[model samples]
Structure formats: structure tokens, C-alpha cells
Target: MKQLIIILFLVVIGCRNETKSDEEIDETVYDMWGDFTQVHPEFKKDELPESWYFHDNKEDANRLADLVMKGKKKASSGLYLWYKEANADLPKAGTKSIITNFDGTAQAIIKITKVDTIPFNQISKEYAAMDMGTNIEPLKKWKKAHWDFFANTMKQGGNEPTEKILVVCERFETIWPKKQ
Candidate 1:
């Protein structure tokens, strides 16, 4: 009885000390944003960029994110229907985003340089190559991977994936974690 209560109290205190408070987490993100603005000095301090990671799978997401940090993968695409169905705003040029790791820690900041809506079948070989992580037949790889991803997304939205479906393509530059 008394021994059980003492053990529970010790566990609670230990957990509280080990866990990061919300303010501490927010400060980490804020510090990253601040570090970014220090180099550019054009972006305001109060407006924090949207933070997100790529891909649904954790390992895939981390790999893609690291590629972005390395400045190898400069572009990406998403199914427009996914945004519409979710009522999410479509990405636009000039907007900044904090690309995060699968664990939700900031990896780099990117500024969208271009945004275009293209039919899935119409994505150019050059653009597909830019979006891919590998040097091999990038267009083929991009088509296979994006097709599977878009099909899954469309199925969840109660829609069917088609070659004519629009994809929001974006090109960005990693502005933070600058060249050392």
C-alpha cells in the first residue's frame, strides 16, 4: 500500500524529468527557424515555416529527407487530389518549409523556387530525374514509385488513380544547414 504509492510517485517524478516539456520542444524548432533567418535576414522571425517530412514510410522518409539535405533531390511531387480531399492548401512558389527527419527534428529549410501542376503522365524525363534519388533511369523509377503512392492516396479518397490526374510539382533549394 504505502510502498506501492512511493514507487508510483518515484516513477512519475522520473518520467517527468526525462520527458521534454512542450516549451522545450517549441524552443528547438524556434532556434532552427532563427538560425535560418540569420543567414537570409529577409524572412521575419515571427513567421515560422511549415515543418514536415516526406514519404509515408519512416525509413523512406528519412532517406528522402537526407537526400534533400545533401542537395541531391531538389524537386518532389504530390497528388493534387490528396490535397483537395484533405482541404490542405496546395504548395506555392516562394513559400518556405522546414524539412524534418522521420523523428520530427528539423533537418533543413527549403524555399520553393517553382510550383507547377502537371498531369502524372506528362511529367518530363528531366523533371523526373531531378525528383529522383538515384542516377539510374530516374523517370522509370519516379513513375513506378509515384504511381504506387498516388494509387494508395486516391483509393483512400474514394477516387481512382489515372494518368491524367494532376500532380503538384515543386522545386526547392535547401536554404538552411548551409554549405560548410
Candidate 2:
């Protein structure tokens, strides 16, 4: 009788141990976002997607933003850089230029010397006039400068236009946690 009792006790303890181990493993698998929040306390109350790792403090947030911005700029610059290299042998003024996304999923074909107007309603009618001409030189310069500024500001914890865009995109890419 004692032998049987001892065997049952051991079996119970083993089952409990197995349960505990499973719980720990599950916690570990989901801890990446939790760990990020711990490091960045400011985001403790902010709602975020499961995949997003946001920082709480201004400094840390800035650092992450910078990294993301740099990545975006690198991606955009590569598009224009390729255009310049491809037309190196062609005449400068008449060369056609095209910039495509890294995945080659989207492209914009632009002609040099054509002027395009961008109107802004947020600003006064006189203040919102932006003429983007189809000069390859100016276009490339604008793209580089715009990307650099955006990346740097994002790194410094400033909000960016792209952030909203990312949020919409994430709905499709991420598997949201079930409601508690």
C-alpha cells in the first residue's frame, strides 16, 4: 500500500512540474513586447499592436525612431541612386528616370523639366505653392534631403506621417491579441 501511495505522489509532482514548465515557456514566447515596454515606461498606458515594440521614455523612443527612419531613407535613396546609375551613359538632359519600390511592386516614371504643382490647403493659398519640376537633379536632391530630415526627426522622438500609414498596414500584417 505504501509503495502505491508513493508512486501516486511522485506522479502528481511530475505532472505539476510539467504544467509549470509549459506556463513558463508560453510567457517567454510572448515577452518580447513586455520587455520593450519595461525599458520604455512612457508607453505603459498606450495601446499598441502585439508586434510593435514602443519605448516609454523620450530618449529611447527617439533612438528606435531613428533606426526606423534610417532604414526608410536607405530604402528610398536606393531607388533614386539606381536611376542615376542606369542612365550614366545617356545624355544628361534627355535621359528618362524611374524610381521603383524595393520589391518592384510600384514605380513612378518622371520626365525631366516638367513642373508639377502641389497645393496645400492647410497653409494659406500663397504659402502652399510647391512646384516640383521634372529635373532629375532637383528631384534627387529633394528626395535625399526629405528622407534625411524625416529620419532624423523620427529618431529624436518626433511624430511622423509614416507612423499613421504603418498603423493601417499593421492591421493586415499582425495577428492581434484576443480581447481579454
Candidate 3:
């Protein structure tokens, strides 16, 4: 009986000694929207979620959101300079994210499957097609629109685009808010 008690005590002490360090514990902690339940009645307070983005204007954002929710679109790209000015954290593989509409309504959650930084002129047709989310838009049209948009955005930030500006390209999979 004494031997068994000693063994049990040692086992408990060993397990206690294996407690996680501060850094490890901190990684598990996250901030969640307090009033999320007001917007999403089914949301749980304790659940930690991914970053959300309002990708564009009403029509474009809604279309892209629907495409993402429907698994029709798989990628997105944005001006790297814009993100830098906003101090936006870069998305990574396996990380989940939410899509929001212009009025800030949650649309769907997506899991980042791939991420890369590429020059605007070097952007592949596949990336543009994915961004379009509908019928394949010609590369020429995509370039014209993106160039104008980026140039304007950069000018607003007190910067100017050179011959080649870098853009962040991301591909993702819809992970939540499935169409039932």
C-alpha cells in the first residue's frame, strides 16, 4: 500500500512539473469580439476566431463573399503597400479568416491554403481568374483595373507606384457558413 501511494504521488508530481510555460500558454490566448453574439446569435464567447476582411465595395465584396462561401473562388490579391500602411498582419496557410460585407456583416469563414508576394506585372492569369470569381476575365482588363486602383491608393498614401509594384496573393478555402 505504501509503495503504491509513493508511486501515485510521484506520478502526480511529474505531471504537475510538465505544466506549460508562459509563452506556450500565451499562444493559446486570443482576443474575441465581445459583442459578437449580438451580430451572430450562435457565436460562443470562448471561441477564438480568425481575422476578418471587408475586401471591397458593396457589389464586388458581396460577389467575392458569395464566391468564397460557394467555393467558387480560391484566391485574392492586394497591394502590399496598402497592407503595410495599415499594419495588417499577413495571412498564412491553415489560418482561418472571415469575410465581411460593406456594412460589416459577417459572410463566411475561409481557411488560407496558400500565400505569396508577387509583382503586379508578374501576376498569373490563374490568380486574376480566381480574383474575378466569375467567368475568366482577360488579363488585360484585370491589369488595367488593378493598376488604376493601386496607383490611386498609393497616391492617397503619399506614395507612387513604380513600374512594378508588389502584391500579396493568397489562396483560400471556404471553411464555414456553408450553403445549405
**Leading candidate by TM-score:** 1
Best by lDDT: 1
**1 versus 3: better lDDT goes to:** 1
Regions more than 4 Å wrong, model 3:
1-47, 50-53, 85-88
Per-residue accuracy of model 2 over 47-131 as CA lDDT, tens digit each:
4321211122344333333333232211111112112223322113222222222221112222233222221112122211111
Tens-digit lDDT string for candidate 1 (7-68): 32222210111223455444446678888777768776557876666765578778887888
Candidate 1, backbone clash total: 0
TM-score of 1: 0.79
Worst 10 residues of 1 by lDDT: 10-19
50, model 3: CA deviation in Å? 4.2
Model 1 clash pairs are none
- With a 3 Å backbone cut-off (N, CA, C), the pairs that clash in candidate 2 are 40-56, 42-56, 66-155, 113-134
lDDT of 3 by residue, 1-180 (tens): 444433322222101112234443322122223333345566664355533343435676666667777777777666665555545566578766556544445566666789888988898877777765655564666688667766765665557787588887878777565324
The better-scoring model by lDDT among 2 and 3 is 3
Query: Each prediction's Cα lDDT score?
Result: 0.70, 0.26, 0.58
